[model samples]
Structures are given as structure tokens and as C-alpha cells.
Target: MLITKNIKMADVIHMNYFTLSVLNRFGIELGFGDKTVAEVCKIENVDVDFFLEIVNAFVDKDYFPKKQLQTFSVKLITDYLRKTHYDYHQIKVPEIESLIEEMVKACYSEKENLVLLKKFFNDYKQELLNHTNREETVVFPYTIAIEDAFNSKTLDNSVFDLMETYSIAIFQNEHENIEEKLFDLKNIIIKYLPQPKNSENCHKLLYALFSLEQDIIDHSRIEDKVLVPKIREMEKVITKRFGEKK
Candidate 1:
């Protein structure tokens, strides 16, 4: 007789607003980890085979499968950013620049207003620089390492332990800080940065800020809701493996 230990099911928790929104946008159904194949089949109104297939698809894409309703992976943080934040900035930054230029043209007729717009752009430029630098230098690289470890099939307990504090926990706090800063910019754009009602240039600037804010919000949601939880779950895997070894 051959014997193999059974892997315990992961726990699935309730879906958050951000996760639901992302699922809707992607036309994907949410998978619950905590439930059994039969249970998820009942909840999702699908058969066991179909539910199992969907879960497999998520796993194929390096997404954690919710077993027992608790599914997570550290790499999910990087994956979410690659799909959402990186993609957003790749498109939004150019759009933002165009909008800023339009505002400059509208303010060209007023020298004083033109000067103010220049300063405003400078401020926003600096903010973008700081944000991108942190992601590139610290956040993205760590995530890439996690993903690489996973793909190479060398992923093990140590990586997960390191990530528990560095990538998962620290990054969660970082997302909160980033969200607050983005919120600050939104308030400034809406209430203080623009006199759009009085000037065409100001109007263009405010619109650009509004669009940028939306993009930032989407970016934040992916990191906070999807990525953080994934990392936490990976920690669980590490614990499980350790227990099994012992």
C-alpha cells in the first residue's frame, strides 16, 4: 500500500468590494477556498467538476485556490500589480501629461495663471517620481523574486517566512500610506489646486487629476485587497509544510 498525507483545505473568507469589482471587470467568477468541491458547487450553482476546473484554472495562473476558504500567496501581490498598477500607469501617465499640456495652453493667455499651472505640474511630477521609485526599488523586485522562486519550483518554507514580514505585512502598511497620499492629492486637486470654473486651463488640470485619482484608487484596491491576503495565505502554506516535516 502507498500512503500520502492529505493536504488540508485552505479557508476561504468573504469577498471584499475590490475583489468583486476586479472579478466583474475581468468576467471571472470568485472561487471560495474554505468550502469543499461539493459546497462550492452548491454556492456557485455549478457542478463539482466545473467548480474544480475553475479552481484549477486559478492555480494554473499562480493564483491561490481557496481551500477551506483561506487561500493566499505572496506572489499574488506582484501579480496583481503587474496586471493593474503597472498597466494603469503605462497608459495613464501619458494621458495625464496630455491633460496638463491642455491646461497650460488654456492658461497661456494669462501669465500669472500659467505660472501657477507650472508649479502644480511640478508638484504632481514629484509625487509620481517618489511613488514609482519605491515600487521599482523595493516592492516590485521583492515580488519578482517571490514569483521567480515559485515558477522555478524551488519555492519552499524559507521564502514564505521571509515574505511574511517583508512582503506581506510591510507591504500592507505601505499600501495604506500610499492610499492616504493619493487621497491628499485628490483633495488638493478638487478643492485647492484648481479654479477651473474661472479658467479653462484650471478646468483641464482638475479633470486630469480626477482621472488620475480613479486610476490610483483601482491600483490601491488591487494591492490592499488581493495582494495582501494572498501573501498571508502563503504564510499558512509555509506553516503547513513545516508541520508536515515535523
Candidate 2:
């Protein structure tokens, strides 16, 4: 869908539920009194183009902002990504873990199996936490450094060396592994886990898993399609600038 300035936020959320998360990243609360996208963004002091690009990308998987990368701040992308990490680690994952514990207690027949399932989830959670921490501690700061150096016209040998040593490609590869583990977790629950006596609990677990899977997919897409590519472009620019010096 063409997300022009006139599109209503309510209408956007109505069309695609995932856009709610996107809007939340921008700190956009609902109940905007029938405001257009541009109008709401104006009130929120958000960059209209960046907002459109992100929301559009969420709505359409293939939508990537190649031209917009030139002007967009890597910090903006990283900050949003960091917020998503916090959401997953601090809120969503803990909620699911608590639900699993509740389900285990509520359904005592398959205690052994439930315990194993909980272990699986805990393992996955740890892996995810580590992954996000690496990005926050290492990759994101490096990307920001590149952007800063680029803007300041400080393209030197050290920057080139940093880019060459550690690139976004590594993080992209790690993302695949993270996604595969999540896929396995979902399949294990769907295929092997016995149904809990409390149907409501089972349903809630499935719903949370489904929601988490979709969120992970969307999150990875933002990193793979938007963040990585923009960083790669920055890499190219820096590489060429350094090459000229050599």
C-alpha cells in the first residue's frame, strides 16, 4: 500500500496489525483524533520521511529505502533496535517464561516434558539476550562510529581497518541462526508438546509464540533489509574514500 502523508494511523493499524509495533517504536500512541500520518508525525516531532520508510517497510517486506539511507541517521535505526531488544528481553520473553511456568504448574501430568520445554525456552532466551547485547555493545556502536566518522570527514586508516575487521555480514549470519532456533522452538511446541488440561493456557502459549515469531521475523527484516544495507552503503563510501587516499 502507498503510505502517503494522508494515510490515517488508525487506518494503517487496521490494515496491518504489525504496524502497531512500528508506531510504538516511534513512541506514537493511539487515539490521535483522526490525524493523518504527516499530521501526527508533525505533532510528535518525527521525521516524516523516516517514519514513512519504516512503516512502509513493515507493511511491505520488499520495501527498502536505498535513497533514504543517504540522509537517515544510523543512530535512529540503532536506537529503535535497542528499544526492541529491551521489549523482547525485559517484557515479552519474561511474560512468556512466566506463562510457561504457570502452565507447568497448572498441568501436572507432563511435568517432565514441561520442564524440558521450559529449559528450551530459557536457552533460547539467553541466546537472544546475548545476540542483542552483542549488537548493542559491539556492532551498533561500531556502525555509529562509522557514521560519525563519515559525517565528520574523518575517513582514516583506522576506520577502514575497523570496517574490514568486523562487518555487518557477521551479524547477518548470526541472525539466521537466531531465527532457526526460534523456528525449532515453535515447531517443538506445535508438534511434540502435549496439550495442557487448561485449554486457555495452551491457547495463550500458542498465541504468544505466534506473536513472538512474527515479531522476530519483522525485527530481523529491519536489521537485514534496512540496517545492514544502510551500513553496507556506509562501508562502501568509507572504503572508497580511504582507497582514494591510498
Candidate 3:
């Protein structure tokens, strides 16, 4: 079901608990006693439109309103992306690592298997960290700069200089398939690894991996489908305007 502003906030949580993370990213928490999404967002000083769009997108896999999302300012999109990164780095990654560690300690027979699993996950973690680092430090800031330059009447040489060397297309091309390795990691747990004596940790690890995989997929979808296209269009405009002078 497509969540609307008129839907009860608590009801939305009942529908998809995963949205709790989405709500938290927006600085919203539980305790809104039957208030609608709109009512709660208004009280919380959140962008109701953006909230609705993001929540709806997350709730319904088929309902990515890319055009509507693209209408939002780059700052808003980048802010959400940064928050998702925070969730991954500060919460999801460590939780998964801990689960893996517990699983490794849970069994003795599969020590070698567990070690190999650890190595695979460590490599995946490093790649994910590096990927997000590039986006946060380089790609996002560059897009924001393009946004700034595109909106401004005064053309600057710096934006053009940056443009000469980089564009959203370049970033899009370089964007690694970080999720592929993650899928492999999940397969290693599901198909290859022997179950530990305390199988709970292994189960938890698989669940965590699946959750993280979906979260990253959704996050990347926003970037690939919405932000990348938006930035590319902006880049075209800025380059055309600035390229005329130089």
C-alpha cells in the first residue's frame, strides 16, 4: 500500500517496521499517538513532501517516483544520502561484524570456514567503506557545487575547472557494484558454511546481511535512478553555459 500523509504514523510503522530507520534518519521517533504522517511531520518540522516520497519509495519497491524525487533540491537528497551512510557506517556494519564474530566463536569444526567468511566480509566492508567515502567526500560535494553553480547567475571558473576533470557520468561509471560481493557473502553463509553449534548467531548474521543488502540496494537506487540523472542534467547546463566562455 502506498503510504500517504493521511495515514496514521503508527500505522505506517506497523506496515513496515523498516521505515523506523527512515523515520529516525529524519529525526523522528515513536510517540506520536495516532497522528497522521502529515500531522507528525508538521509538528517535527520535517519536509512532509520529501518524507512522503522517501517513505513511499522505501515502502513500495515498484513505487520509485524518480521524477518527483528529482524535483527536490540536491541538498535535501544529499542530506538523506549522508544520513543513510551514517546508518551503514555507525550501525549496520558493526552489527553485522559482531554477528560474524559471534558465529566464528560459536563453532570449532568450521573454524577454517569461519575464517574464510571473515576474510570475505572484511574485504566487502573495506570496499563499501571506500565507496561511501568517495561519495561523501567527492561525488556528493561536487554535485552540490554543480547545484550551486547552476543556480547562480555569476559563472565561476572553478566549477568549470572541476567540470573539465569530473562529471556525474564519471562517477556513475566508476560506481562499483558493491552489492555483488555482498550477495556472494550471503551465499557463503547460506550455501557453503557449516552451521555453528549455536546456530542463532549464524541465523542472525544471514538476516543482517539480507537486511543490509536490501538497504544498500534501495539507497543505491536513489542515487542511480534519481540523483545521478539530476546531476547529469545540471552538469550539462553548467558546462554549456561555462563552456561558451572558455
Computed on alpha carbons, the lDDT of every model, listed in order, comes to 0.50, 0.80, 0.88
TM-scores of the candidates in the order shown: 0.52, 0.89, 0.95
- C-alpha lDDT of residue 14 in model 3: 98
Output the number of the TM-score-best candidate.
3
Ranking by TM-score: 3, 2, 1
Ranking by lDDT: 3, 2, 1
Tell me how far candidate 3 lies from the true structure as C-alpha RMSD in angstroms: 1.3
Please report the candidate that would top lDDT against the real structure.
3
- lDDT per residue as tens, model 1, 208-230: 56555655654655455555565
- Which model, 2 or 3, shows the larger lDDT? 3
Q: Model 2: per-residue lDDT, tens digit, 185-234?
A: 77887787777778787677777877677777767877777788888887
lDDT of 1: 0.50
Worst lDDT window (10 residues) for model 1? 1-10
Better of 1 and 2 by TM-score: 2
Give the runs in model 3 whose Cα sits over 4 Å from its true position: 243-246
The segments of candidate 2 whose C-alpha lies over 4 angstroms from its true place after superposition are 65-71
Inter-residue clash pairs, candidate 3: none
